[model samples]
Target: MDSKYCPDCGHPSSIKRIDRKYIIHEIEHVLHFERGILYTIRELILNPGENIRKYLSENRSRLVKPIIFIIVTSLIYTILTHLFHIEDGYVKYHEVNDGTVSTVSKIVKWIQEHYGYANIMMGIFIALWLQLFFRKFNYNFYEVLIMLCFVMGMGMLIFSVFVILQAIMHFNVMSFAGAFGIFYCVWAIGQFYFKSKVSSYIKGFFAYILGMVTFWIFPVIIGIVIDVVSK
Candidate 1:
């Protein structure tokens, strides 16, 4: 029996794991807001860079896993938008042919529907630009990707806040939400590298904006090429 458990953490082997107590405990923990999703959001909202740095260097257990955090947050935002019936520029792509949906339009629609998974894909794309701009810092590409998962996860929450406000106020505030979302992302990434110099922040802005532009523009270009080739 002892051999069936992990030597380090005493976790049971796959064959011995018939119980779902762990699953129930996790759900209870989240429902109670005890050092889980809510805690991660709070730390991220207040001091994302410092806290993420701490999570990377000091104690990983304090936060939800980066990828999981992003997925959960993205889902929350997705649900909020759906509940409010909100429309934003992020999903409004123009189709070239009338009565026909272009590949790019389909992609946009998919992204909107599955923002949780799509966020991870978008994070990977944005990480490339961050790697180029922040190469001097010596952080590897995957590290930037991890940082983005947390930062952009918070970005989703930030957008969710604006959505709630709009719903309550009965007015349009999505424009401000998008602008502030970008600003928060740039600031978080900048502060993550170093907060002393303005150069880090400036570079962060270019890194993020370029990454976003390249992500969207690349898809549009490919869709255009494919459309032309088919015609």
Candidate 2:
């Protein structure tokens, strides 16, 4: 009759069954949902800097504890995409009805058409640039970069799963979610990274603005580079 509280809502668990497998599975599901909501809540509640400090100073698990959250969020994101069929006008080459483009060509064309690939890469760069802007805070440049890289890895993990879902359902939500999600997750990382760099609250806010702007502009700059490289 031992009982536990729900990880997500902090509600008391009313175990419906005493079977070990069922209990274990149920607990895992609760923790998963709890993690996603917690990540979203924390991001919404604190300005980037404070959130970072909170994770940094507290338990190690708090830092980048968004893995389970990311998976859950991504799955829900996939489901919604399937249901709504939101259109960003991105089509894989072979899927195009015109039949003029090879699959690789279509992928490249899709990247060019919807501004997806570069925009996605820009999201990562913005996180890196933000970290550099606040280089004097505490950690070395590499350390900040590593943290951002981890953020990107987490982002790609969720994004990959979403892409798989899109393939199966013939719906295209992955590009939009991946692009925007990378921006947010990286920004989340930057929020904490800047706090660690700058001790003063005021400076941290400035860094946040700079980071935001850098994120917005990064795609254009990288697009130019890609255009040049392709030439």
Candidate 3:
């Protein structure tokens, strides 16, 4: 009879070899708070391009998966915003206008309340857009999504810190952070996908703009469809 192989450690396994120690170690490696998660977050923030390139080229076993990183950072962002009582300008605008928020405003508020999910949706849209815009690169949708997950996760982490500071300092810094995020996205794409800085910058600029427009327009289009269907 052939021996079964352990999928994780890639060694021959038997029922007798499965023990408490092995189970505990596996759980700790996969779910412990401090292992690869912190390292990946720091690398993503300090040296995103190189970090992403290394993950793409080298073994990814040591790093937290990009999707999990994005989700964790996004949850932290959401929690921080609530904890700090960070006021969104959109909400403030609607609050000041006749004390009656419109349907569009309501939609925007729902989107903001679920910002993490919205971000994932936007990431999908941007990935598709990039696949089309950079078709010559010949990268698949999943690869682009992996890159975007890292980029967006890093952006969210930076944005969350700025939000905390803005709350404490009583100054608006989100615009600055938003601008930096856009620039960082451009630089990351340039570093990973394009050989020429000039070409990458040009494409990244247009791609970012288009991404923003699509994100904003998508909700409006959906709202319109909903209204039409109800009527």
Q: Which lDDT value does model 3 have at 224?
A: 68
After superposition, candidate 1 runs with Cα above 4 Å error: 1-34, 89-91, 229-231
Which stretches in model 2 have alpha-carbon errors above 4 Å?
1-36, 39-43, 62-64, 89-98, 102-123, 140-231
Ordered from best to worst lDDT, the candidate numbers read 1, 3, 2
Residue 157 of model 2: what lDDT?
Answer: 46
Q: Each candidate's TM vs. the true structure?
A: 0.84, 0.42, 0.77
Report the lDDT of model 1 for residue 175: 77
Q: Write the per-residue lDDT of candidate 2 for residues 1-231, one digit (tens) a residue.
A: 555988779887874667998888776665554345456445533564454455455543443443344334434444544555543322232334564434344344544443323334443554465556566667655444434433443454455456556767776666675465445554555466543443433443454346546654454466556656876
Residue range 75-164, candidate 3, lDDT tens digits: 778788888887562223333487754566667787777766767777888887788778898678888888888887777887788888
lDDT winner, 2 or 3: 3
Whole-model lDDT per candidate:
0.81, 0.49, 0.73
lDDT per residue, candidate 1, 1-231, as tens digits?
448778998886655453698777767665444657678888887888899899878998888888877888888888898899886733456656788878777667777788888778888878998888778877788888999999988888888999899989988888788789988998899779997778888988888887777777777787778878988
Q: List the residue pairs that clash in candidate 1.
A: none
TM-score of 1: 0.84
How many backbone collisions does model 3 have?
0
Candidate number with the higher lDDT (1 or 2): 1
